[model samples]
Target: MALRHFFLILLVVSIWAFNNIAIKWGLLDLPPLMLTTLRFVVVALILVPFTRVNLHQLRYLAVLAFTFGFMHFSLMFISLNNTDAGTAAVIVQLGTPIAMLLAMVILKEKLRLVQLLGIAISLSGVVVLSGSPTIPNWWVLVLMLLSAFGWAISNMIVKKSPPISPLTMTGWLSFLAIPIVGCASWLTESDQITLLVNASWRGWFAILFSAIGSSIVAYSLWYSLLKHYNVNLIMPYSLLTPVLAVIMGVLVLGDSMNGFKVTGSLLVILGTAIAVINLRNLRMHAKLARFRYAGRSKGH
Candidate 1:
Protein backbone atom coordinates (compact mmCIF):
# COMPACT_ATOMS: atom_id res chain seq x y z
CA MET A 1 0.00 0.00 0.00
CA ALA A 2 1.15 3.53 -0.67
CA LEU A 3 1.77 5.86 2.27
CA ARG A 4 -1.26 7.97 1.35
CA HIS A 5 -3.66 5.00 1.29
CA PHE A 6 -2.26 3.85 4.62
CA PHE A 7 -3.06 7.25 6.05
CA LEU A 8 -6.51 7.08 4.44
CA ILE A 9 -7.20 3.77 6.16
CA LEU A 10 -6.09 5.30 9.43
CA LEU A 11 -8.38 8.24 8.83
CA VAL A 12 -11.33 5.97 8.02
CA VAL A 13 -10.84 3.85 11.13
CA SER A 14 -10.40 6.95 13.23
CA ILE A 15 -13.73 8.29 11.95
CA TRP A 16 -15.35 4.97 12.80
CA ALA A 17 -13.75 4.91 16.23
CA PHE A 18 -14.93 8.40 17.06
CA ASN A 19 -18.40 7.44 15.82
CA ASN A 20 -18.89 5.37 18.94
CA ILE A 21 -18.32 8.45 21.02
CA ALA A 22 -20.57 10.39 18.70
CA ILE A 23 -23.40 7.90 19.23
CA LYS A 24 -22.95 8.12 22.96
CA TRP A 25 -23.06 11.86 22.75
CA GLY A 26 -26.17 11.84 20.59
CA LEU A 27 -27.88 9.49 22.99
CA LEU A 28 -27.44 12.07 25.72
CA ASP A 29 -30.01 14.39 24.16
CA LEU A 30 -31.96 12.21 21.71
CA PRO A 31 -33.70 8.92 22.33
CA PRO A 32 -31.79 5.97 20.91
CA LEU A 33 -34.27 5.04 18.22
CA MET A 34 -34.90 8.67 17.45
CA LEU A 35 -31.21 9.32 17.09
CA THR A 36 -30.96 6.43 14.66
CA THR A 37 -33.91 7.70 12.68
CA LEU A 38 -32.42 11.16 12.39
CA ARG A 39 -29.00 9.87 11.38
CA PHE A 40 -30.42 7.92 8.47
CA VAL A 41 -32.65 10.82 7.54
CA VAL A 42 -29.48 12.82 7.05
CA VAL A 43 -27.90 9.99 5.11
CA ALA A 44 -30.90 9.65 2.87
CA LEU A 45 -31.00 13.33 2.16
CA ILE A 46 -27.38 13.31 1.07
CA LEU A 47 -27.01 10.03 -0.78
CA VAL A 48 -30.44 9.00 -1.97
CA PRO A 49 -30.23 11.30 -4.96
CA PHE A 50 -27.29 9.32 -6.33
CA THR A 51 -28.84 5.89 -5.82
CA ARG A 52 -30.49 3.87 -8.58
CA VAL A 53 -31.78 0.32 -8.21
CA ASN A 54 -33.80 -1.94 -10.43
CA LEU A 55 -37.01 -3.69 -9.41
CA HIS A 56 -35.20 -6.99 -9.11
CA GLN A 57 -32.86 -5.47 -6.54
CA LEU A 58 -35.55 -3.99 -4.37
CA ARG A 59 -36.26 -7.06 -2.26
CA TYR A 60 -32.64 -7.69 -1.44
CA LEU A 61 -32.07 -4.05 -0.68
CA ALA A 62 -35.11 -4.05 1.59
CA VAL A 63 -33.78 -6.99 3.52
CA LEU A 64 -30.41 -5.32 3.72
CA ALA A 65 -32.03 -2.15 4.97
CA PHE A 66 -33.97 -4.00 7.63
CA THR A 67 -31.15 -6.16 8.86
CA PHE A 68 -28.29 -3.70 8.62
CA GLY A 69 -29.93 -0.35 8.98
CA PHE A 70 -32.86 -1.00 11.24
CA MET A 71 -32.05 -4.06 13.33
CA HIS A 72 -28.33 -3.43 13.67
CA PHE A 73 -28.40 0.30 14.33
CA SER A 74 -31.53 0.20 16.48
CA LEU A 75 -30.21 -2.52 18.73
CA MET A 76 -26.76 -0.99 18.77
CA PHE A 77 -27.91 2.45 19.81
CA ILE A 78 -30.19 0.98 22.43
CA SER A 79 -27.38 -1.20 23.75
CA LEU A 80 -25.08 1.79 23.81
CA ASN A 81 -27.58 3.53 26.02
CA ASN A 82 -26.78 1.02 28.76
CA THR A 83 -23.22 -0.01 27.95
CA ASP A 84 -20.06 1.96 27.50
CA ALA A 85 -19.11 2.90 23.93
CA GLY A 86 -15.83 1.03 24.13
CA THR A 87 -17.50 -2.11 25.38
CA ALA A 88 -20.12 -1.88 22.67
CA ALA A 89 -17.39 -1.50 20.07
CA VAL A 90 -15.60 -4.61 21.30
CA ILE A 91 -18.76 -6.68 21.52
CA VAL A 92 -19.88 -5.84 17.97
CA GLN A 93 -16.71 -7.50 16.66
CA LEU A 94 -18.61 -10.74 17.23
CA GLY A 95 -20.33 -9.99 13.92
CA THR A 96 -17.19 -11.17 12.14
CA PRO A 97 -17.22 -14.71 13.50
CA ILE A 98 -20.97 -14.79 13.24
CA ALA A 99 -20.67 -13.89 9.55
CA MET A 100 -18.11 -16.66 9.12
CA LEU A 101 -20.48 -19.17 10.66
CA LEU A 102 -23.32 -17.98 8.48
CA ALA A 103 -21.19 -18.38 5.39
CA MET A 104 -20.40 -21.95 6.34
CA VAL A 105 -24.07 -22.77 6.62
CA ILE A 106 -25.60 -20.67 3.88
CA LEU A 107 -22.83 -20.40 1.33
CA LYS A 108 -21.15 -23.73 2.03
CA GLU A 109 -17.86 -22.04 2.78
CA LYS A 110 -15.32 -24.13 4.66
CA LEU A 111 -13.55 -22.81 7.71
CA ARG A 112 -10.03 -23.82 8.58
CA LEU A 113 -9.30 -25.19 12.05
CA VAL A 114 -7.50 -22.02 12.98
CA GLN A 115 -10.58 -20.00 12.17
CA LEU A 116 -12.65 -22.23 14.40
CA LEU A 117 -10.21 -21.72 17.25
CA GLY A 118 -10.33 -17.98 16.68
CA ILE A 119 -14.11 -18.02 16.94
CA ALA A 120 -13.94 -19.92 20.20
CA ILE A 121 -11.42 -17.51 21.63
CA SER A 122 -13.49 -14.53 20.59
CA LEU A 123 -16.62 -16.01 22.16
CA SER A 124 -14.77 -16.68 25.39
CA GLY A 125 -13.65 -13.08 25.45
CA VAL A 126 -17.27 -11.97 25.18
CA VAL A 127 -18.08 -14.24 28.11
CA VAL A 128 -15.32 -12.62 30.10
CA LEU A 129 -16.43 -9.14 29.14
CA SER A 130 -19.98 -9.90 30.18
CA GLY A 131 -18.80 -10.70 33.69
CA SER A 132 -17.39 -7.22 34.15
CA PRO A 133 -18.87 -5.27 37.08
CA THR A 134 -19.37 -2.19 34.97
CA ILE A 135 -22.25 -3.74 33.08
CA PRO A 136 -25.52 -2.28 34.26
CA ASN A 137 -27.60 -5.12 32.89
CA TRP A 138 -26.89 -8.46 31.26
CA TRP A 139 -29.75 -7.94 28.86
CA VAL A 140 -27.84 -5.16 27.18
CA LEU A 141 -25.18 -7.69 26.30
CA VAL A 142 -27.86 -9.86 24.77
CA LEU A 143 -29.06 -6.88 22.78
CA MET A 144 -25.53 -6.31 21.58
CA LEU A 145 -25.24 -9.94 20.55
CA LEU A 146 -28.46 -9.74 18.60
CA SER A 147 -27.19 -6.55 17.01
CA ALA A 148 -24.06 -8.36 15.90
CA PHE A 149 -26.17 -11.15 14.47
CA GLY A 150 -28.16 -8.60 12.50
CA TRP A 151 -24.94 -7.25 11.10
CA ALA A 152 -23.83 -10.72 10.12
CA ILE A 153 -27.11 -11.32 8.36
CA SER A 154 -26.64 -8.10 6.45
CA ASN A 155 -23.20 -9.22 5.33
CA MET A 156 -24.69 -12.41 3.95
CA ILE A 157 -27.31 -10.41 2.12
CA VAL A 158 -24.64 -8.29 0.56
CA LYS A 159 -22.71 -11.35 -0.57
CA LYS A 160 -25.79 -12.84 -2.18
CA SER A 161 -27.04 -9.67 -3.82
CA PRO A 162 -26.26 -8.61 -7.37
CA PRO A 163 -23.42 -6.27 -8.11
CA ILE A 164 -24.12 -2.81 -6.79
CA SER A 165 -22.05 0.15 -5.81
CA PRO A 166 -21.40 0.38 -2.10
CA LEU A 167 -22.60 3.94 -2.00
CA THR A 168 -25.78 3.09 -3.87
CA MET A 169 -26.52 0.22 -1.54
CA THR A 170 -25.85 2.40 1.44
CA GLY A 171 -27.98 5.21 0.10
CA TRP A 172 -30.99 3.04 -0.61
CA LEU A 173 -30.48 1.21 2.64
CA SER A 174 -30.58 4.47 4.54
CA PHE A 175 -33.54 5.76 2.58
CA LEU A 176 -35.45 2.54 3.14
CA ALA A 177 -34.52 2.41 6.80
CA ILE A 178 -36.25 5.69 7.45
CA PRO A 179 -39.78 4.29 7.67
CA ILE A 180 -38.85 1.16 9.58
CA VAL A 181 -36.84 2.93 12.23
CA GLY A 182 -38.93 6.06 12.22
CA CYS A 183 -42.09 4.12 12.92
CA ALA A 184 -40.40 2.28 15.76
CA SER A 185 -39.25 5.55 17.22
CA TRP A 186 -42.74 7.00 16.90
CA LEU A 187 -44.41 4.05 18.57
CA THR A 188 -41.96 3.39 21.38
CA GLU A 189 -40.28 6.70 22.16
CA SER A 190 -41.93 9.63 23.88
CA ASP A 191 -41.18 13.34 23.59
CA GLN A 192 -39.79 13.00 20.07
CA ILE A 193 -41.20 16.28 18.88
CA THR A 194 -39.95 18.17 21.90
CA LEU A 195 -36.59 16.46 21.82
CA LEU A 196 -35.99 17.25 18.18
CA VAL A 197 -37.06 20.76 18.70
CA ASN A 198 -34.79 21.26 21.68
CA ALA A 199 -31.82 19.11 20.63
CA SER A 200 -28.50 20.85 21.15
CA TRP A 201 -25.58 21.28 18.77
CA ARG A 202 -23.89 18.14 20.14
CA GLY A 203 -26.89 16.06 19.20
CA TRP A 204 -27.03 17.48 15.68
CA PHE A 205 -23.28 17.16 15.31
CA ALA A 206 -23.42 13.54 16.30
CA ILE A 207 -26.01 12.77 13.67
CA LEU A 208 -24.11 14.65 10.93
CA PHE A 209 -20.76 13.07 11.79
CA SER A 210 -22.18 9.58 11.88
CA ALA A 211 -24.11 9.99 8.65
CA ILE A 212 -21.44 11.84 6.69
CA GLY A 213 -18.08 11.16 8.24
CA SER A 214 -18.59 7.57 9.30
CA SER A 215 -21.05 6.21 6.77
CA ILE A 216 -20.37 8.29 3.67
CA VAL A 217 -16.75 9.39 3.77
CA ALA A 218 -15.28 6.46 5.66
CA TYR A 219 -17.03 3.78 3.63
CA SER A 220 -16.29 5.53 0.31
CA LEU A 221 -12.58 5.60 1.08
CA TRP A 222 -12.67 2.10 2.49
CA TYR A 223 -14.36 0.62 -0.57
CA SER A 224 -11.98 2.51 -2.81
CA LEU A 225 -9.06 0.89 -1.00
CA LEU A 226 -10.66 -2.53 -1.26
CA LYS A 227 -11.04 -1.96 -4.97
CA HIS A 228 -7.30 -1.35 -5.41
CA TYR A 229 -5.87 -3.86 -2.91
CA ASN A 230 -6.62 -7.41 -1.90
CA VAL A 231 -9.07 -7.68 0.97
CA ASN A 232 -6.53 -9.47 3.15
CA LEU A 233 -4.20 -6.52 2.87
CA ILE A 234 -6.95 -4.12 3.94
CA MET A 235 -8.90 -5.98 6.61
CA PRO A 236 -6.23 -6.16 9.31
CA TYR A 237 -6.23 -2.39 9.60
CA SER A 238 -9.87 -2.49 10.74
CA LEU A 239 -8.86 -4.27 13.94
CA LEU A 240 -7.57 -0.94 15.09
CA THR A 241 -11.09 0.54 15.18
CA PRO A 242 -12.23 -1.00 18.45
CA VAL A 243 -8.82 -0.52 20.01
CA LEU A 244 -8.96 3.16 19.15
CA ALA A 245 -12.53 3.31 20.38
CA VAL A 246 -11.48 1.89 23.73
CA ILE A 247 -8.74 4.44 24.11
CA MET A 248 -11.00 7.32 23.15
CA GLY A 249 -13.75 6.05 25.42
CA VAL A 250 -11.37 6.17 28.34
CA LEU A 251 -9.77 9.51 27.60
CA VAL A 252 -12.71 11.35 26.06
CA LEU A 253 -15.75 9.83 27.70
CA GLY A 254 -14.04 8.74 30.89
CA ASP A 255 -15.37 5.21 30.52
CA SER A 256 -14.04 2.89 33.18
CA MET A 257 -11.63 0.12 32.13
CA ASN A 258 -10.85 -2.67 34.57
CA GLY A 259 -8.79 -5.84 34.30
CA PHE A 260 -11.61 -7.94 32.86
CA LYS A 261 -12.39 -5.35 30.23
CA VAL A 262 -8.72 -5.05 29.31
CA THR A 263 -8.12 -8.80 29.19
CA GLY A 264 -11.30 -9.51 27.29
CA SER A 265 -10.51 -6.80 24.76
CA LEU A 266 -7.08 -8.28 24.14
CA LEU A 267 -8.52 -11.71 23.57
CA VAL A 268 -11.16 -10.44 21.17
CA ILE A 269 -8.65 -8.36 19.22
CA LEU A 270 -6.10 -11.16 19.16
CA GLY A 271 -8.65 -13.74 18.09
CA THR A 272 -10.02 -11.50 15.35
CA ALA A 273 -6.49 -10.85 14.09
CA ILE A 274 -5.79 -14.56 14.07
CA ALA A 275 -9.02 -15.42 12.31
CA VAL A 276 -8.80 -12.76 9.63
CA ILE A 277 -5.14 -11.84 9.30
CA ASN A 278 -3.22 -15.03 9.99
CA LEU A 279 -5.59 -17.24 8.03
CA ARG A 280 -5.28 -15.07 4.93
CA ASN A 281 -1.50 -15.14 5.17
CA LEU A 282 -1.54 -18.90 5.60
CA ARG A 283 -3.66 -19.34 2.51
CA MET A 284 -1.45 -17.03 0.47
CA HIS A 285 1.71 -18.80 1.58
CA ALA A 286 0.24 -22.22 0.82
CA LYS A 287 -0.72 -21.13 -2.69
CA LEU A 288 2.77 -19.71 -3.29
CA ALA A 289 4.42 -22.94 -2.10
CA ARG A 290 2.27 -24.99 -4.44
CA PHE A 291 3.19 -22.78 -7.38
CA ARG A 292 6.92 -23.03 -6.55
CA TYR A 293 6.72 -26.82 -6.24
CA ALA A 294 4.98 -27.05 -9.61
CA GLY A 295 7.67 -24.84 -11.22
CA ARG A 296 10.48 -27.04 -9.90
CA SER A 297 8.73 -30.24 -11.05
CA LYS A 298 8.38 -28.79 -14.58
CA GLY A 299 12.05 -27.76 -14.58
CA HIS A 300 13.15 -31.37 -13.94
Candidate 2:
Protein backbone atom coordinates (compact mmCIF):
# COMPACT_ATOMS: atom_id res chain seq x y z
CA MET A 1 0.00 0.00 0.00
CA ALA A 2 1.11 3.54 -0.69
CA LEU A 3 1.96 5.76 2.28
CA ARG A 4 -0.98 7.99 1.52
CA HIS A 5 -3.40 5.06 1.51
CA PHE A 6 -1.94 3.83 4.80
CA PHE A 7 -2.51 7.24 6.33
CA LEU A 8 -6.04 7.25 4.94
CA ILE A 9 -6.61 3.89 6.58
CA LEU A 10 -5.42 5.37 9.85
CA LEU A 11 -7.87 8.22 9.41
CA VAL A 12 -10.70 5.73 8.89
CA VAL A 13 -9.60 3.82 11.98
CA SER A 14 -9.66 7.02 13.99
CA ILE A 15 -13.15 7.82 12.78
CA TRP A 16 -14.40 4.36 13.73
CA ALA A 17 -12.68 4.48 17.10
CA PHE A 18 -14.52 7.64 18.01
CA ASN A 19 -17.74 6.27 16.55
CA ASN A 20 -18.25 4.13 19.64
CA ILE A 21 -18.28 7.30 21.70
CA ALA A 22 -20.77 8.82 19.27
CA ILE A 23 -23.04 5.85 19.70
CA LYS A 24 -22.83 6.20 23.45
CA TRP A 25 -23.47 9.93 23.26
CA GLY A 26 -26.52 9.46 21.05
CA LEU A 27 -27.85 6.70 23.26
CA LEU A 28 -28.15 9.09 26.17
CA ASP A 29 -31.32 10.48 24.60
CA LEU A 30 -32.23 7.99 21.88
CA PRO A 31 -32.89 4.31 22.19
CA PRO A 32 -30.31 2.06 20.53
CA LEU A 33 -32.57 1.02 17.66
CA MET A 34 -33.84 4.54 17.18
CA LEU A 35 -30.33 5.97 17.15
CA THR A 36 -29.39 3.45 14.49
CA THR A 37 -32.52 4.29 12.49
CA LEU A 38 -31.76 8.01 12.52
CA ARG A 39 -28.17 7.32 11.58
CA PHE A 40 -29.10 5.43 8.42
CA VAL A 41 -31.77 8.00 7.62
CA VAL A 42 -29.14 10.71 7.68
CA VAL A 43 -26.74 8.61 5.62
CA ALA A 44 -29.42 7.89 3.00
CA LEU A 45 -30.67 11.45 2.71
CA ILE A 46 -27.17 12.81 2.19
CA LEU A 47 -25.62 10.26 -0.17
CA VAL A 48 -28.48 8.44 -1.86
CA PRO A 49 -29.07 11.40 -4.15
CA PHE A 50 -25.70 10.84 -5.81
CA THR A 51 -25.79 7.06 -6.00
CA ARG A 52 -27.25 4.82 -8.67
CA VAL A 53 -28.07 1.23 -7.80
CA ASN A 54 -28.46 -1.77 -10.08
CA LEU A 55 -31.64 -3.78 -9.78
CA HIS A 56 -29.79 -6.85 -10.97
CA GLN A 57 -27.77 -7.14 -7.76
CA LEU A 58 -30.64 -6.61 -5.40
CA ARG A 59 -29.97 -9.97 -3.76
CA TYR A 60 -26.40 -9.07 -2.90
CA LEU A 61 -27.45 -5.66 -1.71
CA ALA A 62 -30.16 -7.20 0.45
CA VAL A 63 -27.62 -9.53 2.00
CA LEU A 64 -25.38 -6.57 2.78
CA ALA A 65 -28.33 -4.74 4.31
CA PHE A 66 -29.03 -7.61 6.65
CA THR A 67 -25.41 -8.12 7.60
CA PHE A 68 -24.31 -4.48 7.93
CA GLY A 69 -27.54 -2.58 8.38
CA PHE A 70 -29.68 -4.77 10.62
CA MET A 71 -27.22 -7.09 12.30
CA HIS A 72 -23.99 -5.11 12.66
CA PHE A 73 -25.24 -1.62 13.42
CA SER A 74 -28.20 -2.71 15.54
CA LEU A 75 -26.14 -5.00 17.72
CA MET A 76 -23.21 -2.62 17.81
CA PHE A 77 -25.21 0.41 18.89
CA ILE A 78 -27.05 -1.66 21.45
CA SER A 79 -23.80 -3.10 22.71
CA LEU A 80 -22.31 0.36 22.96
CA ASN A 81 -25.36 1.52 24.86
CA ASN A 82 -24.74 -1.22 27.42
CA THR A 83 -20.93 -1.47 27.47
CA ASP A 84 -17.82 0.68 27.68
CA ALA A 85 -16.78 2.12 24.35
CA GLY A 86 -13.23 0.80 24.64
CA THR A 87 -14.34 -2.68 25.58
CA ALA A 88 -16.85 -2.80 22.77
CA ALA A 89 -14.15 -1.71 20.35
CA VAL A 90 -11.72 -4.34 21.55
CA ILE A 91 -14.31 -7.07 21.44
CA VAL A 92 -15.25 -6.13 17.92
CA GLN A 93 -11.72 -6.98 16.74
CA LEU A 94 -12.78 -10.58 17.15
CA GLY A 95 -14.29 -10.01 13.75
CA THR A 96 -10.82 -10.24 12.28
CA PRO A 97 -10.43 -13.88 13.21
CA ILE A 98 -14.03 -14.50 12.28
CA ALA A 99 -13.39 -13.04 8.84
CA MET A 100 -10.26 -15.14 8.45
CA LEU A 101 -12.19 -18.29 9.26
CA LEU A 102 -15.00 -17.37 6.90
CA ALA A 103 -12.51 -16.65 4.13
CA MET A 104 -10.81 -19.98 4.69
CA VAL A 105 -14.13 -21.78 4.36
CA ILE A 106 -15.81 -19.73 1.67
CA LEU A 107 -12.88 -18.60 -0.41
CA LYS A 108 -10.60 -21.57 0.19
CA GLU A 109 -7.94 -19.18 1.44
CA LYS A 110 -5.06 -20.51 3.50
CA LEU A 111 -3.49 -19.13 6.63
CA ARG A 112 0.17 -19.25 7.57
CA LEU A 113 1.21 -20.76 10.89
CA VAL A 114 1.92 -17.29 12.17
CA GLN A 115 -1.53 -16.13 11.17
CA LEU A 116 -3.16 -19.04 12.98
CA LEU A 117 -1.06 -18.33 16.04
CA GLY A 118 -2.05 -14.71 15.89
CA ILE A 119 -5.72 -15.61 15.78
CA ALA A 120 -5.33 -17.81 18.81
CA ILE A 121 -3.43 -15.14 20.69
CA SER A 122 -5.88 -12.39 19.83
CA LEU A 123 -8.85 -14.55 20.79
CA SER A 124 -7.19 -15.34 24.10
CA GLY A 125 -6.73 -11.67 24.72
CA VAL A 126 -10.42 -11.09 24.15
CA VAL A 127 -11.25 -13.85 26.59
CA VAL A 128 -8.93 -12.34 29.16
CA LEU A 129 -10.39 -8.89 28.75
CA SER A 130 -13.99 -10.04 29.01
CA GLY A 131 -13.23 -12.10 32.09
CA SER A 132 -11.73 -9.09 33.81
CA PRO A 133 -13.65 -7.70 36.75
CA THR A 134 -14.26 -4.24 35.28
CA ILE A 135 -16.79 -5.33 32.70
CA PRO A 136 -20.36 -4.56 33.69
CA ASN A 137 -21.95 -7.55 32.01
CA TRP A 138 -20.89 -10.61 30.06
CA TRP A 139 -23.87 -10.53 27.75
CA VAL A 140 -22.74 -7.17 26.37
CA LEU A 141 -19.55 -8.78 25.07
CA VAL A 142 -21.62 -11.50 23.45
CA LEU A 143 -23.69 -8.89 21.65
CA MET A 144 -20.52 -7.18 20.49
CA LEU A 145 -19.23 -10.49 19.20
CA LEU A 146 -22.41 -11.01 17.26
CA SER A 147 -21.99 -7.58 15.77
CA ALA A 148 -18.42 -8.48 14.86
CA PHE A 149 -19.60 -11.67 13.21
CA GLY A 150 -22.11 -9.70 11.20
CA TRP A 151 -19.38 -7.33 10.10
CA ALA A 152 -17.09 -10.19 9.11
CA ILE A 153 -19.81 -11.88 7.09
CA SER A 154 -20.67 -8.60 5.42
CA ASN A 155 -17.03 -8.12 4.41
CA MET A 156 -16.91 -11.53 2.77
CA ILE A 157 -20.10 -10.75 0.91
CA VAL A 158 -18.66 -7.50 -0.36
CA LYS A 159 -15.55 -9.33 -1.55
CA LYS A 160 -17.63 -11.84 -3.45
CA SER A 161 -20.01 -9.35 -5.04
CA PRO A 162 -19.41 -7.82 -8.42
CA PRO A 163 -17.61 -4.51 -8.44
CA ILE A 164 -19.88 -1.73 -7.29
CA SER A 165 -18.90 1.71 -6.11
CA PRO A 166 -18.66 1.72 -2.32
CA LEU A 167 -20.53 4.98 -1.88
CA THR A 168 -23.34 3.80 -4.13
CA MET A 169 -23.75 0.56 -2.20
CA THR A 170 -23.51 2.36 1.12
CA GLY A 171 -26.20 4.86 0.14
CA TRP A 172 -28.52 2.20 -1.15
CA LEU A 173 -27.78 0.14 1.94
CA SER A 174 -28.79 3.01 4.18
CA PHE A 175 -32.00 3.42 2.22
CA LEU A 176 -32.80 -0.27 2.57
CA ALA A 177 -32.07 -0.37 6.29
CA ILE A 178 -34.24 2.59 7.25
CA PRO A 179 -37.52 0.70 7.32
CA ILE A 180 -36.18 -2.40 9.03
CA VAL A 181 -34.43 -0.48 11.76
CA GLY A 182 -37.23 2.09 12.07
CA CYS A 183 -39.76 -0.66 12.61
CA ALA A 184 -37.48 -2.34 15.07
CA SER A 185 -37.10 0.93 16.93
CA TRP A 186 -40.83 1.45 17.06
CA LEU A 187 -41.55 -2.08 18.19
CA THR A 188 -38.87 -2.30 20.86
CA GLU A 189 -38.51 1.24 22.14
CA SER A 190 -40.79 3.84 23.67
CA ASP A 191 -40.55 7.62 24.05
CA GLN A 192 -39.15 7.88 20.52
CA ILE A 193 -41.16 11.04 19.88
CA THR A 194 -40.57 12.40 23.35
CA LEU A 195 -36.82 11.79 23.30
CA LEU A 196 -36.17 12.85 19.73
CA VAL A 197 -38.13 16.02 20.30
CA ASN A 198 -36.21 16.73 23.49
CA ALA A 199 -32.79 15.64 22.29
CA SER A 200 -30.06 18.22 22.87
CA TRP A 201 -27.30 19.46 20.61
CA ARG A 202 -24.92 16.85 21.96
CA GLY A 203 -27.25 14.04 21.03
CA TRP A 204 -27.90 15.51 17.60
CA PHE A 205 -24.16 16.02 17.12
CA ALA A 206 -23.52 12.39 17.91
CA ILE A 207 -26.08 11.32 15.36
CA LEU A 208 -24.64 13.54 12.66
CA PHE A 209 -21.11 12.44 13.46
CA SER A 210 -21.99 8.78 13.21
CA ALA A 211 -23.98 9.22 10.04
CA ILE A 212 -21.62 11.46 8.14
CA GLY A 213 -18.17 10.70 9.52
CA SER A 214 -18.35 7.02 10.35
CA SER A 215 -20.94 5.65 7.96
CA ILE A 216 -20.48 7.77 4.91
CA VAL A 217 -16.84 8.81 4.88
CA ALA A 218 -15.10 6.06 6.85
CA TYR A 219 -17.05 3.15 5.37
CA SER A 220 -16.78 4.47 1.83
CA LEU A 221 -13.01 4.74 2.19
CA TRP A 222 -12.87 1.31 3.81
CA TYR A 223 -14.76 -0.35 0.98
CA SER A 224 -12.57 1.36 -1.56
CA LEU A 225 -9.48 -0.04 0.18
CA LEU A 226 -11.01 -3.50 0.25
CA LYS A 227 -11.58 -3.26 -3.48
CA HIS A 228 -7.91 -2.50 -4.08
CA TYR A 229 -6.17 -4.77 -1.57
CA ASN A 230 -6.38 -8.19 -0.01
CA VAL A 231 -8.80 -8.46 2.89
CA ASN A 232 -6.16 -9.73 5.33
CA LEU A 233 -3.98 -6.74 4.63
CA ILE A 234 -6.84 -4.31 5.11
CA MET A 235 -8.37 -6.03 8.13
CA PRO A 236 -5.32 -5.85 10.38
CA TYR A 237 -5.52 -2.07 10.40
CA SER A 238 -8.69 -2.59 12.48
CA LEU A 239 -6.47 -3.51 15.40
CA LEU A 240 -5.72 0.19 15.70
CA THR A 241 -9.41 0.92 16.22
CA PRO A 242 -9.43 -0.62 19.69
CA VAL A 243 -6.30 1.23 20.75
CA LEU A 244 -7.73 4.56 19.68
CA ALA A 245 -11.10 3.69 21.17
CA VAL A 246 -9.51 2.91 24.49
CA ILE A 247 -7.77 6.25 24.56
CA MET A 248 -10.91 8.16 23.57
CA GLY A 249 -13.09 6.17 25.93
CA VAL A 250 -10.81 6.85 28.84
CA LEU A 251 -10.56 10.57 28.11
CA VAL A 252 -14.13 11.23 27.03
CA LEU A 253 -16.24 8.68 28.89
CA GLY A 254 -13.97 8.18 31.90
CA ASP A 255 -13.93 4.48 31.26
CA SER A 256 -11.83 2.50 33.70
CA MET A 257 -8.33 1.66 32.54
CA ASN A 258 -6.45 -0.95 34.46
CA GLY A 259 -3.38 -3.09 34.01
CA PHE A 260 -5.31 -6.14 32.89
CA LYS A 261 -7.19 -4.30 30.15
CA VAL A 262 -3.97 -2.69 29.01
CA THR A 263 -2.20 -6.01 28.82
CA GLY A 264 -5.07 -7.58 26.94
CA SER A 265 -5.12 -4.77 24.41
CA LEU A 266 -1.41 -5.16 23.77
CA LEU A 267 -1.80 -8.90 23.26
CA VAL A 268 -4.54 -8.34 20.73
CA ILE A 269 -2.47 -5.85 18.77
CA LEU A 270 0.64 -7.99 18.81
CA GLY A 271 -1.26 -11.08 17.73
CA THR A 272 -3.01 -9.29 14.90
CA ALA A 273 0.30 -7.92 13.64
CA ILE A 274 1.72 -11.42 13.73
CA ALA A 275 -1.20 -12.80 11.75
CA VAL A 276 -1.40 -10.15 9.05
CA ILE A 277 2.11 -8.90 8.41
CA ASN A 278 5.25 -10.32 6.68
CA LEU A 279 3.35 -12.50 4.22
CA ARG A 280 5.57 -11.27 1.41
CA ASN A 281 8.66 -12.06 3.43
CA LEU A 282 7.30 -15.51 4.24
CA ARG A 283 6.89 -16.24 0.52
CA MET A 284 10.37 -14.91 -0.17
CA HIS A 285 11.83 -17.24 2.44
CA ALA A 286 10.17 -20.19 0.75
CA LYS A 287 11.53 -19.15 -2.63
CA LEU A 288 15.05 -18.81 -1.22
CA ALA A 289 14.86 -22.31 0.29
CA ARG A 290 13.72 -23.73 -3.05
CA PHE A 291 16.59 -21.99 -4.85
CA ARG A 292 19.18 -23.37 -2.42
CA TYR A 293 17.76 -26.88 -2.85
CA ALA A 294 17.89 -26.57 -6.67
CA GLY A 295 21.54 -25.39 -6.58
CA ARG A 296 22.53 -28.34 -4.35
CA SER A 297 20.77 -30.81 -6.67
CA LYS A 298 22.70 -29.47 -9.67
CA GLY A 299 26.00 -29.77 -7.78
CA HIS A 300 25.16 -33.41 -6.99
Best TM-score among the predictions, by candidate number = 1
Model 2 Cα RMSD, 1 decimal: 6.3
TM-score, every prediction = 0.93, 0.86
lDDT of 2 by residue, 1-300 (tens): 568899999999999999988888888888999999998899889988987777766678888888989889999899888878988888777777788888989999998888899988988888778866556788887888899899899989989887778787888888898888899988999989899999988689888999999978898899888888766567767778989999999999899888768877777777767776667865665687699889989999
lDDT of residue 88 for candidate 2: 80
Q: How many residue pairs clash in each candidate?
A: 0, 0
Cα lDDT for residue 220, model 1?
97
Model 2 worst lDDT run, 10 consecutive residues: 277-286
Q: Candidate 1 lDDT, tens digit per residue, 1-300?
A: 468999999999999999999999998999999999999999989988877899878889999889999879999999999989889999898889889999999999998999888888998899899888756788998999999999999999999899888888888999999999999999999999899889898899889999999999999999999998778878889999999999999999999989989988888888877777765566786698699889989999
Score residue 228 of candidate 1 by CA lDDT: 86
RMSD of each: 4.5, 6.3
